[model samples]
Target: MRDSVSKDTLSDVKVQQRERGTLWERVRPGSLLMLVATCVGALLVLSPFLLVVLNAFKSPADYSTRGPLALPANFDLGPLQSYLDIIDFPKALTNSIVISVVVAVVGVLISVLAAYAIGIGRIKMRTGVLAVLLLGTMIPQEALIYPLFYIAQATGTLNTIWSVIIIFIVLQGAFGTYLLAGVLGTFPRELLEAARVDGASRWRILWTVVVPVIRPTLAVLMVFFFIWTWNEFYIPVVLLNSQDAQTIPIALATLRGQYTVDMTVVNAGSFLSLLPTIVFFLIFQKTLSNGVTAGAVK
Candidate 1:
């Protein structure tokens, strides 16, 4: 009887114990599994960056001889310099930066206004308005390409950087508005009431009270919008026909041939292209983390 009780206690303890060798506690079977899955996902997401950095320094001869997976015998900046010259990289980089920054700022403003109206303005048919914006986002860009192209041409903005920036501002704004409206809907009413009770106007309240409270979330949105616009390829490729107006993603595609691609040169350009966004993300990462958790805290 004593032996059976001791064995049963040990079994119960083992069953309740956290699964070892992983970072997460095994509160249930799902938690340990989720930890493993997250690790795999992080690695998959980071693999492309690793591959680009690895091959970017390799010479064309070395890449062809050793295949794509092997380590480089020596680092060479020749491919990096050559790729930069081939694509006139500085011009592309500058154009990309300007367009992304403009879109991010404008997009955030549009989202804030739209969200304010939908979330707190006591407007009629608020759900309808949100539904329309949601539908706009859901409609695949492929289906709207023709209409967008025709509009751009008619406006005489075709093949210009403005075309890309304008399109992204509208697109990004719609999504941001949809997302931010939800955030604003649950805003602290006591704060808004206190502001209004103190004789503040609506616009003043927004900029001073509401905007300041949600500034971290807005920063996250701006960073994401900037990155999204920076990575745009399809619309820019079609609309910005002029080589001078093309963004980095479009410029990268121009290097590929019908039959073959230069892996070394392309990787060098990819590595360079990846750097600015990485740096931008790193700078804003803390703000992003805070924004993500802000809603949970209060």
Candidate 2:
């Protein structure tokens, strides 16, 4: 009986050891390292925005007296209120919304059509056309700034919101086309053939079948374009010299004085400016994720 009990105990111990080893193998050391790396990367990426929010609530005296990374002694809304009042926040916000919306909607529309032509229609010289469009994306915006300025001046579009809106539409539309074309190219040809066999015109098929299938991609592009246009500084600053036509970014820049800068107030404005983009992403994050992964499966 003693020998049998000892043998049973030994077997049980071995079983437990095997289970523990299997669990460790499933998790693996590499997975732990990846998790740690992901956490560190997230912290690094969010640190700047977190600092902006933390400093925004502090008073100028507190911000100056204490370290920038330090927590605010007390929360206050006065600085943000003052910043808004001084900068004419409503006017700038309105201009930004209008420009961003117009650019996003119109640009996406143009892109969808162009993408359909090259990707679905499979027009002649399609490869060459796509190569040219992709090349446009590689060109630095700085290189075109001079030509854009000259063109805007000659056309009497200087200091106008339309100038900024039109420029963004053209640039963003090209990129959107490239992205959407890739997604559309992966679409099953059988679906298009079926639609064609059903006596559906190319336009009808695009609107009915293609649009529904690619709605997620379009949503992603619209959100990106809107956020980009809303936060654009360089083009708006160079083109919109007048205060009345300036967007939120240009308006925010005016918060800094030539002689003296208020770090707290600037932080407040920066935080407020980020609100729209944060809200937008929260609203469309699901669609954006779906769009990004849509083509991966098939």
Candidate 3:
């Protein structure tokens, strides 16, 4: 009887042990790994921005003497104030804003229309055309500096804001269209067909159906174009000969001198240059993750 009882208990315990298994197995390893990776990536990308923001509030003495890792014992707004006064911050800011806004808006608009035409419209030799467009995106713009210089000079746009705006639009929009075309290609043709069945004209369909559905792609393009245009240094430095036509990037570069660099003021100016893009992202960043991803998938 005692042996039978012991055997029964052992059997029941073995069954329960089999049911318990490992908790880790219940949670997906891939998901856990992805979460860890995403957190690390976020920190890596955002650390520089955060560091600049923190340093913006530090005095020149504090920033240079103390290590960057150290926190300011007392927050100071004086550095930003002094820096702004020292560099005619308002004028630089206005130039940056105007150029960035123009480039982003125009680039996205033209790219959207162009991408739609290539992706959905029955353009002749589409594969060949798309191949050409791909080449345009891959080619380095630096190679065309002299050609652009002559063109700008011939067109009488040298040392003007319009020159920068126009160049940026064309440069960034090509790449923007490349990305949007990929997203647009993933869209279902049935929707366009249905719109046509309802007697919607091509223009109407593009404006109403296509634009609304592809807002995600457009939003992403806008953010990217704006950031690129705002940060553009090379073309502006080369083309812009006058201070009045200078963008924030050019203005910030001018902060350096032959003898010494103004670390505090340069950091302050750099912080200012970043603010517009940061604000734009904060406003529309949802498109980056969900909207863009969903549109691409759809």
After best superposition, candidate 3 residue 294: deviation in angstroms? 1.9
> Model 3: clashing residue pairs?
none
lDDT of 3 by residue, 151-188 (tens): 99999999998888998888788887777777677767
Ranking by TM-score: 2, 1, 3
Q: For model 1, how does the per-residue alpha-carbon lDDT over 1-298 read when each residue is reduced to its tens digit?
A: 9999999999987766634523344266887789899999999999989999999999999999998889998988888988987898888999999999999999999999999999978589989989999998899889889999999999999988998888999999999999999989988899999999999999999999999999989998998999989988888889988989988998899989899888899999999999999999899889899988986786
Best-performing candidate as measured by lDDT: 1
Instruction: Write the residue-wise lDDT of candidate 2 on 1-298 in tens digits.
Output: 9999999999999999999999988997889999999999999999999999998898988988997989889998877987888898888888999999999999999999999998887889988888888888889888889999999999999998999989999989989998888878888899999999999999999999999988877988898899888878888899999989989899999988989998888989999888878887898889889988975765
* lDDT, candidates in the order shown: 0.91, 0.90, 0.82
Q: What's the TM-score of each model vs. the native?
A: 0.86, 0.86, 0.80
Model 1 spans with C-alpha error above 4 angstroms: 1-42
- C-alpha lDDT of residue 30 in model 2: 88
Each candidate: RMSD to true structure?
7.0, 4.6, 6.3
Residue pairs with backbone overlap in model 1: none
- Measured on C-alpha atoms, candidate 1 has an lDDT of 0.91
Over all chains combined, what TM-score does candidate 2 have? 0.86
